[model samples]
Target chain A: MPNRARFIVQIILLFLITLHARPPAAHEAPPSVRAELPLLTAPAISREGYFTLQLQSLPTVPLVVEYSTDPQFTQVTAQYPWFADFSQMTLSGFPNGQHYFRLAQAGVDGSAPNQVGPVVMVRVQHYPLNLAIGLLCFGGAMFGLLVVMIVRGHWSRSRYE
Target chain B: MSEPISYALPTSLGVALIIAFGILWIFYGWYLGRKNQTHDDFALAGRQVGLALAMATAMATWVTSNTTLVAPQLAYQLGIWGMVGYSFAALGLILFAPLAARIKQLMPMGYTSGDFIRLRFGRAAWWPFIVISLIYALGWLVSLGMAGGILLQALTGLDYHIGMSVILFICVGYTLFGGLRAVIATDFIQTVVIIIGVVVTAWFLIDKVSLASIHQNLSDNHPKLLDLLFPAALMFLFNNIFFGLGEIFHSNVWWSRAQAFRKGIAFKAFLIGGLLWLPIPIVTGFIALAAPQLGIYPPSADMIGPMVTAQVLGKVGAVIVLVVVFSALASSLDSLLAATSDLITRDIYCQFFNPEANDQQLIRWNRLCLIGLGVFTWLLCLPQVATLAALLHFTGAFVASTIFPIVLGLYHPKLSGRTATLAMIAGSTLGLISYFVVGFYVAALTSSVVSMLVCVLGLRWSTTSFRWQQLQESDGC
Candidate 1:
């Protein structure tokens, strides 16, 4: 009786582990073949170091985007899983450099990705910090002058009245 | 592997709520409008608004769709400074408090800001000022109209065009019936709704997503958003301040309110209103910072605020967002429609066509003008021209140019009409060039500086002084 109980417990534990380790059912399905790859487009230049990439003709399968600093993507910087299947993805916080991005059907069962889209590059060039600070100071001075003018004008008018 | 969570509210339910609110407002408008026996009562609310209503209208009208929608969009794009910068807009109201008192004293029977420009600066300055005023008013109207659609679609998955048209029709219906009286009364109630809804949403967001986590996620993923030295955001701060000042100083919307409020209320009411409105953007804006942690990447940036709220709190949250945004939209939209129509009727139609038009004729024209402005705004909104913030800042170039001229013309005796006119033209021209050449962030700042320089030059060069009494124009109606 003791041996039989131990055997049952081991079987239950193995089943639970297997259930937890199985791949999601959606990913197990065979990938759909498409006539044309999704068209990816991005702005030619981004002054703010951020731009949106638009994917047209998106496939039903889950997608992943890989971005790198090089055209050939020799050393991939990051691979982002596209969330919620949105057509437009806005990637921000690039440090004022050229970044290349492309979309692909995420690999299933540890297999290679299928149908990679053409690469698009976005050049990010931020405004000069000095110019930004200069404008800020100019604005501050003008605002101060405005306050002075208003206060003086009001005081003078009140005195006269 | 999970599907995207769909919109929180059902289309039918959202439509039902809008229709219900529409009926309530229109009925109330008609109920209050019965007391409007003359054009004065219709246009200026009989100049008898008490302190409480005065404060409510000031706060509510300034709490525009831009505050609720665009504030979050800015925060999402520009980070912490975005919200803080937006709060700077309350300065427009705070600064306008003293100006409001002066406006009342100067032109106790004034109909619009245009009346002041025309009377104080004469026809030369009046022409450019009128053009700027109309362009800004139309831009604001269209933006409000578009906001109505965007908010509805974001929360309920409703079609943008339908939502936009319904909101416009509803606001026009109420304003046409009740006039400024209805607008103010509803604004008081909408103010309550907006405050409670916004606080509730913010509280829930903070409770669900800890601020530390939000900060951690942003720091790790989008480091620029947390950077204090963000260049574009730094430039945007003062430009936004000038934009707000220009918006309030030159728009007939605020002027009409200043004219409508009872004696001795404009200053304190605006002061209190500005104080109450100072923190709203910060509360609304920080919610967007939680989006990345929740895996909510909105298709468009403008939808970030509602999407995150709805995502966290589900259906109830969607309902709250819908009501709050709808109220914000209506409060400003109705005011803009009524005020812009007043400008057209008093400044353009009556002043140009028939100065002898009686009270009854003026009232009729005012109502017709309301419809006309609504239709024109609808036509502009149909195209979904640009994002709300982009469209709004585009008009900043035109309105900011008028800021210095309006301020100096009001107080400085030596600033002549010709100089003011030249100032507006030069400021607007350079501002537009900067907008295309540099960016929208500098449009208002550049415009205000140019206008100020022109005014300073005029003050030095001029020999004449403006008589203050010229502002007390006789109400022909």
Candidate 2:
């Protein structure tokens, strides 16, 4: 029991090098909330397919907008806006399927993360082929069983002689 | 020194150790070849394998290249459940004990499970069974070959092609010379090394990183990783159980081991192996919590477990990780060699090519086939391009997807071999579609279900029912 307890403790301390990769403990401040800031108070869009993103920030605090199909930070928009009407903003720039958007509230002093929102998982539906051959297999089995039965019965009848 | 236990080995030393170990492993075969006893000595060690060794080999083989490489990949990204899902698959072996015992009773002197398929089902079914086993054997060879290459790239600075070719060539050389003796003896040694290495890494890692810390860190930063009740996690676990059960039940690898055992040992080994194997993936996966915090993102699924070891423990730590992986890779590769060679020699050669061949002639042919298969896989492994998991999963899916035919064929003697074959053809093709259409994980489940349905329905149409007790004692040819 003591060894098991010691074993458990040692593992935790080793894993402590990267805390956020796991769930937050009772005492720890959630990293999600630590990322919150006033200058970059961008309203996170809830439903990714069709939802308006609202931005709330000081006029002096210029916000840079970005969107991407991936959760990664490769998609930054050139256009700056105090408040860009997302209805006019082209959603077409984003890929056809689910995407992520990040808004940065920035001052000239520093461009650090004011805040980050939830990571969204989206499934895109594209119609194509799936398991159709599986259906064909069912058809084939019926045919084979039919023949096996025919042969088995003939063999049985001959054996009766 | 203050790092995690998994990080104790250096990367350079790790790679060198793996290469050194492979060279040493061949000698076991060379030795086995010198003792040219009867078929008993070659195939089953005259039924002399100890409980401990038997237990270890059974567990080691079931663990597979996938257990070390693929399980952690799924665990890291798909979250904890991916690892859990795989670990849960061990239940398949446990459930299969009854079947194993029945087989032992049916074929006390069986050479391979192919024997059971041949005698009860007759020649009409033998060819179809052979074809299924053929696809499985060759496909397994290629996947393990691919795994060896990936392990090389991870452990050493070696190119994928070189690493893979080296491993395959070495495995083939010994397997051709030694037959089942080489495979099982080496499996025993590999199992010992693997246990020591894995137990140390997992134990040390667990001691270093507490369960409490993992829960705390994941909840605070990446809550997704800690969600044990995640929906995908739930589906993944159940689907994997069925997938695993069907695969182990139907395949010649387990079948050959069962045939090689004393009448009772096969069942005992499987039950014990299943229990022992249940914890390995979970222990290794807990290390992945360091991925995000350490800024170590795995390039591919196969790299996650070792990469984490390096990030947390540094170069020396990574080397210990390498030794564990080497053990896993060898254990799985040797099983593929022995089982595939058995399939070719017994099913195709003796049954179809030359039925008049004596035991001595056929045993010689088995050794030759072992060499041929080894060479074939070695050549295939020379060009390494695909991710480790993809190579195995896709190929494994090709064979694993056919589990339905073997299972249904065995239990319900009325099921037409035609139905089993066609269902397999259907299952494999459709399984490929599912892999591309949905995802790799779901494809396995879909194929099993599709094949089972065809088997069940086809049996209903047959006029004669099967008697379970009438099974044959003859195995192979």
Candidate 3:
């Protein structure tokens, strides 16, 4: 197709997207996760906040993010692809001791629609972003060393001359 | 009869002032630093920009008036998490320090990330990436311009059109003339004024009301807003990182800085710039405390920081607020003009129009393009925009997906031209789909994953085949 025709399609697509985009729900999808897809195995109340949820997306997609909470269930969020950090969150807002949090899954795309799963809740506070943080540091440090080496090589060449 | 006075100059007057300032600044830059003949001089101040100057320029520019003027809505509605989330954007500059060096090494002659996408990704995929990246740059430039007019109207009582036009002319004047050199020099001064304005306002707020008292006020008055892990707040971190990284990774604005800095200036400039940049949002956010009792809702999020400053420090505060906001406007506008000019000159001009344009000829057009771009940008910024984040995110989501392209493309030889191009198109298309189509970060995330999967699957196919002979032929090694 000519570039001009492609441009028109692109603009039309943009306008349609805006018109269809619902205000995103608290989690990736609102209306909750699918009950049928993944079973929430764990019990409703425990000391540390934990929960497991299962559902499929991609019109039949499987990957989903899960989060558990203390009762009062202050915050709940799910990003598509359900990376590790999106699922781990500390419980705030609820009173202390036992709190039950629910779980569900939805496709990031609007296709299959996420359904509410059976709520298997664990109580908890402060889930770590250790893995992601570790990667950031490791990547940053390795790049720093590479930069240093290159700069040093230049410095040494001038010195030798 | 005296109308309710806005300290902002009349729109017409503001326009005149803005253009005059632009002209004045350009000449000053030209007089102090003659024509920068080489890419190094034109892009960076001979790569000798000190940490203080670099840090200031980075901070002042990144925190455009929208950040100061509007972000308070987040603070007002969401509480602490909102401002803190906004401040986290500084991490973009800090973390990017390491990546800059790698970029420099990979494309020593590169003018924009556009060049990288084009070079790494084959023809089938380049146009989508180009459209996405350019859309983002233009969107950002326009948003800042919109903010400039809104700010001028609020503060000085100027007409919106005149205010915006004035602001645009001022930015174009210096950036079009001085290139990056003028932009960087003004950033040094802009930073100082911004710091002074934000800090003094914060100090006064703290003096007026104790931190403990403010805490008590939040707990009493708007308890839910203080809820730490509000679902929106929790989502804010990842969302911001995606938004920030996209700009840092894909936009030539940052890439130009990376290239311009002398061999080592990239790391220092980005790092120090990030650190100094981090504390500012927090300082500005804290000032909202002074008006806890007043129930002072700003005109919009963009109005929050300035309104708070005005409320706490009074008219004198308003003056300082305008200066600080203007500084930010200048820093970003100048950097963008130079970066965009570089893109047009190197990628488009040299490639399509004049493959053999000599260096001198290239420099001349770069200047001309810089002027032309400034005018184009100025013309666009004159319109009003509704949601700053909507505008920002529409562009940001597409750019964010490029992280896969730049990072993976650098080290992974297996990530071939076809794969790179596919990855960019798939990621951006999905991102746009999520933002515009599906209509949320979650959907956007889904699109990014799908795009990523396509790239990964492609990678797996090529990797698993393990054509050792083909690797020998194609690999940079």
Candidate 4:
């Protein structure tokens, strides 16, 4: 009877170890745990290369964000470690293109796995260069005219004063 | 996250510093207040400010929270053009030098820019002008208040509300006690602190990180920042210039300065002030370009300046940033409080409610108005609406519209009051439309163009010639 009880206890302990030993998968997480995964949201379009990425909630663990050209994130272009406990991050200096991003839990050694959240897309479209140049010329002309007006006005007014 | 970003300075230290500065400034204000014997002395520093004080006040006021905070923000957001574009704001002071001379000559007794608009144009123009001035003043006050909160919170983790209220209270206390006299005297001291702090911080940043590495990192990561022909930045350049011009041309802040300086001092002081102020934004701005290399990403763009400084220099950096930002905030906040109150007291209260008010009565009204303005500004700043740059640029539409009208009214005799009124209205309407329709980069430009067109047409068609003598109201109307 004692041998039988020990066998049962060992089986239970083995079962618990097996359950806890499996590596955590972001998608395979239980429904309740998955529901707490942080969501990443970004503007649909960015006129400038820079745009802000907002997380739905504060990250409880260290997180790194990976970006790719494709939604599947097959080939990660870059990874940025979210340094602080901030819900929002302003990323700048991207060349114009469509980018896909996803958040993942960073391991103790800085390896990012257990990807969380849905993939987000941001399309970067810069303003037309010609329009910018045209505005610049127009502005320069106006500025010059203003300078002349002020200098002349000052000079002319000074003689009388 | 790696240890949750900790502030370099503790909250207790920040609170203690604020208390110390607050007491010192309030005491100094009381000391200066003893000399204010009349309304003019309270409102315009007796119109006796010498060149040294005049230059220092002008430079210090221009080196506002905008310079310390928004300049770096723009550089971070808009790249090379941002700092360069912001430095263009000095042109406002430079151009206003001539206008300052003209202003001093035209209305020797002028108390506010609204006074000039009312006497130069009629009631029609005065209404819109006053509305624009008040809105800009309030916007500036709220921005300054917001900057103070942001500065303290970024460095010391202080509550935003507490930091903001302390700054506003300190500024209002000083301006209320000593009026323009206290504002100017404090401004001189603040200017010294700001210059020394900013230079030291920049010097340390350069020592810690080589410019080549910063340049290389930006080139690799943020290539657009290096692009000379960046679209949004290009558009922002001209828009910012006009915004600065509008801000200086129409604001009671600059007008009161013009009125305060001694007769021979106005032009030179502004000129010297502008030249001195020209390079400050560049110094403040370049530090932000180094942010990414240091792996410091501010949750908000406006905090980048102080964050970068703190990240590089640690606790000492925090102390320097706090003191410099406090000085920058106080210099401009006190000036705005004193100037705006003068506008309300003289233009609105005296003109509308009681023209028969004596010097003592006017002084009392000005102090009350100062408190009211401070309270109203605090209420507005509580919500912390929009980024500092956005809040500042929104007023560009309203103020930019006044540029041509003010210029024409001062120089061109053919521009009548009705035409000037139409110009301001049309300019402001179109500018606001553009602000919503296109982007912030076009608002001021659109306003300036439209207003100039209206003024040109007015000059061509109008036969009315305004006599400059009408501005010299003996009863201080």
lDDT of 3 by residue, B195-294 (tens): 8877777777778667787677666544544666544444444555556766776788887777666665677778788888887777776665443443
Sort the predicted structures by DockQ, highest score first. 4, 1, 2, 3
The TM-score measured for candidate 3 stands at 0.69
Docking class of 4: incorrect
* Model 1 TM-score on a 0 to 1 scale: 0.91
Cα lDDT, model 3, residue A139: 37
User: Which residue pairs does candidate 4 place in steric collision?
Assistant: none
TM-score for each of the candidates: 0.91, 0.71, 0.69, 0.92
Give the chain A TM-score for each candidate. 0.65, 0.29, 0.28, 0.71
Better of 2 and 3 by DockQ: 2
- Candidate 4 structure quality by residue, lDDT tens digits, B138-201: 9999999999988887777666777888788879988989999999999999999999999999
Q: In candidate 3, what are the lDDT values of residues A10-61, reduced to their tens digit?
A: 7445433432222112112222333354433444442212122322232222
Model 2 achieves a DockQ score of 0.03
Evaluated on CA atoms against the true complex, candidate 1 attains a DockQ of: 0.12
The CAPRI class of candidate 3 is: incorrect
List candidate 2 segments past 4 Å from native. A1-161, B1-15, B210-222, B229-232, B396-405, B408-419, B466-477
**Each model's C-alpha lDDT?**
0.85, 0.59, 0.58, 0.86
Q: If the candidates were sorted by their TM-score against the true structure, best first, what order would they fall in? A: 4, 1, 2, 3
Poorest stretch of ten by lDDT in candidate 3 chain B: B468-477
